[model samples]
Target: MEFGAVSDEMEVKAPAAEAWKVYSTLQLAKLVVEMRPDLVEKFEVVEGDGGVGTILKLSFPASTPVFTYSKEKFTVVDEEKRVKEAEVIEGGYLNLGFTLFRVRFEIIEKDEITCITKTTIEYEVKEESAANASFVSTQTFVEIMNAVATYLTTKQL
Candidate 1:
């Protein structure tokens, strides 16, 4: 039933800021862009403070089989814990079934040298959209998480 949401969590041996830098970098978008290279032609810069209001156009490839969206607006930026996030909202067509589906990555420090990144996705699929059979949501999420793990483990930052 949870075909729309793919989430994973990973622990890192680096400071939050260290890992944050990589995730916050503009290059990070390319990882996801590989899945939908046609969708995100590039990053749309906004706010200018390296925060908020940035949007990416996600596009599907011409050679793909499934009729998927070429673009979805996923984002990376600093956010306060428990403080409601206003930017980087998701929904529209990936709406699952409801008008308010969302995906988010939250990072928290466990200590001076440890941090955990939690990926949360809320997908409210209606009966019409819930009829799909093959599902790789969780696996996709795990892959994303592993990417972060790999990035964080590459160095002892």
Candidate 2:
């Protein structure tokens, strides 16, 4: 197996607690789908709440060349650290030979009124399908960060 990871960070003009309120709950998922309908067709809750063990089924538009849907379970939700991790349990990268695919979001405080949204993508793929690892990218996370930051900043005003 081959493991790979990629990360990206975005600075937001909002408090860490404010950012965590969204990242640590299903609000972030709903915001993403509402803000970017072109990227996500649907966001459904399969089980659990917004805490650890929560399962989310995300569907992409038919125009998406890759897999149309993915089921991810929140494996980690550390309120103190303002970190959340979700692991893809079905579809998505799994169908592409990836044995593991996890996305981690960390809200780090920069100051009382500034914070950084860090996103990390970790995946393991069969050695023969190592080429599939290239599909993993932090671009989508960056987009989410942008949307969230804009939403939070405007909502505060």
Candidate 3:
């Protein structure tokens, strides 16, 4: 098994406030569930202002059952910077690893009716539990980001 991380970036046609509504809100988890109901079985916000220090209980469904990493503890949120951070993820059945994930959304207002949003994801993988687990996580990371972008973009209009 080898430790690895996945990062992805995307652009959205929405203003920063619009983007923040999706990225900064805990409700955005619902968008993830809506996009991939098969992967996101259950998600519950545990704490915080729903902005920072929020823990999400993430499980799975068929075709994308998440057997590892049961929960994520989000610790940072800077609306001014459009950034949020989470850590101490349980890489269940994998490395029992501790991981951190950060998402930043920058809104570029192009016009009154349109805004361009750029999103970035950075991850830190602490250990490798299994080769299969590593593969699954990396793939899921990309899928999750893409799903978020898709979810937000579809609502832009």
Candidate 4:
């Protein structure tokens, strides 16, 4: 198997707590679907309630050339540390021969009124299908972060 990881961070003009309120819950998925319909076509909760063990299904627009849907389960949700992790259990990269695909979000406190949104993608693919790893990128997460930051800052105004 081949393992790979990518991460990116964005400075947000909002408190860590405020950012956590969205990142730690399904609100982030909702925001992404609402803000980027071209990227996410639908968001649905398959099980649990926005917490650890929760499963979410995301559908991509038809224009997307890759997988159409993905199901991810929340493996970790740490409010104290402001970190959350979701592992893709089906579809998405898994269909492309990836053995594991996980996304992690960290909201770090920069100050009383500012915070950093860190996003990471970690994956393992079979050596025979290592080429599929190229599809993994942090660009989508960066776009989501931008939308969330813009929403949070605007709401604070």
Candidate 5:
């Protein structure tokens, strides 16, 4: 059995190239943490390049605590479309309640200096972990996108 999906979109003030540079690289979690360590305690790349098959381990701050540690692997990377998809292979959300968790990020060019960032989260819950479903929030991705947008815009100037 599977739950529904959630999707969010935000327009960034930076160009598609800049957004792609950040998202298409394995440095995504690192870059975001560097800009906002308050939100993330640490981000480590366990394996692979920014491309498909990359694995990233992430730790969150106690303040916004969820899963202290999470391991994710990139399942898809389409640079030409500026889209990347990752799945939770281990840790964090899975340990909490989710049976399956995956996210897809798409950066679409709106103009020479602007782009739209879209994130879609698809998940399924374990029967025993239904109560823990509340811990999963799509807003987290929106906040991350906002943070990344701010960082990229600042670096562009």
Candidate 6:
């Protein structure tokens, strides 16, 4: 099995604390759904207390270019560091040939009113599924960050 990882970083216009609140809670999904329902048809907490063990079931609309749905569980949450990690334990990624798919979101505090969002994706794709894995785009994180930043900036007004 071959392992590969991709990382994307975005400078947010809001404070680290504000960005942390958005990234560390379920609010992030809500923002995504509100801002881009076409990309996410549904977002629900299937289990857990919205913590490290929390399970989220995400459904994608038929117009979505990627997976139709995914079941992910929070594997790590470090509030002090403003970091959260989730693993796609079931759903489309697995069906598309990925043996493992995990995403890590880190909000770095640069100052009182600025921060950077670092998104990392680690995956292991089976040899037979390698051809299908090329469609995975890291730019999705950038788009999400832009949307969240816009939301936070407007909320502060």
lDDT of 6: 0.88
lDDT order, best first, reads 4, 2, 6, 5, 3, 1
Question: Candidate 6: which stretches are off by over 4 Å?
Answer: none
Question: For each candidate, what is the lDDT?
Answer: 0.52, 0.95, 0.58, 0.95, 0.85, 0.88
Write one digit per residue (lDDT tens) for candidate 5, span 2-113. Answer: 3858889999999998898888886678877887787677978899877899998888888866667788999999988889999998987788778889999999999999
Question: Which segments of model 4 are wrong by more than 4 Å?
Answer: none
**Total clashing residue pairs per candidate?**
10, 0, 2, 0, 0, 0
Per-residue lDDT tens digits for candidate 4, residues 1-157, read 9999999999999999999999999999999999998888998899999999999999999998989999999999999999999999999999999999999999999999999999999999999999999999999899999999999999998
Query: Tens digits of per-residue lDDT for model 6 on 5-109?
Result: 888998887899999899898998999999978767789999987689999999999987667999999999999989999999999688888998898999998
- Per-model TM-score on C-alpha atoms: 0.62, 0.98, 0.67, 0.98, 0.91, 0.95
lDDT: which candidate is best?
4
Model 1 lDDT tens row, 1-157: 3345556677877777666665565455665564334433334433343344455444445553444442344344554451112222443344334433455666678888788877666555556666542332455445655666676677554
lDDT of 3 by residue, 1-157 (tens): 2444444454555555766677677766787777877667668766655766677877777554435336666667777766666554554332433244444445455665455555454554444533343433335545666676666667655
List of clashing residue pairs for candidate 6: none
Off by over 4 Å in 3: 1-5, 65-69, 91-142
True lDDT of residue 149, candidate 6: 90
Q: What is the lDDT of residue 107 in candidate 5?
A: 98
Considering lDDT, which of the candidate structures 1 and 3 is the better prediction for this target?
A: 3
Which residue pairs show collisions in model 4?
none
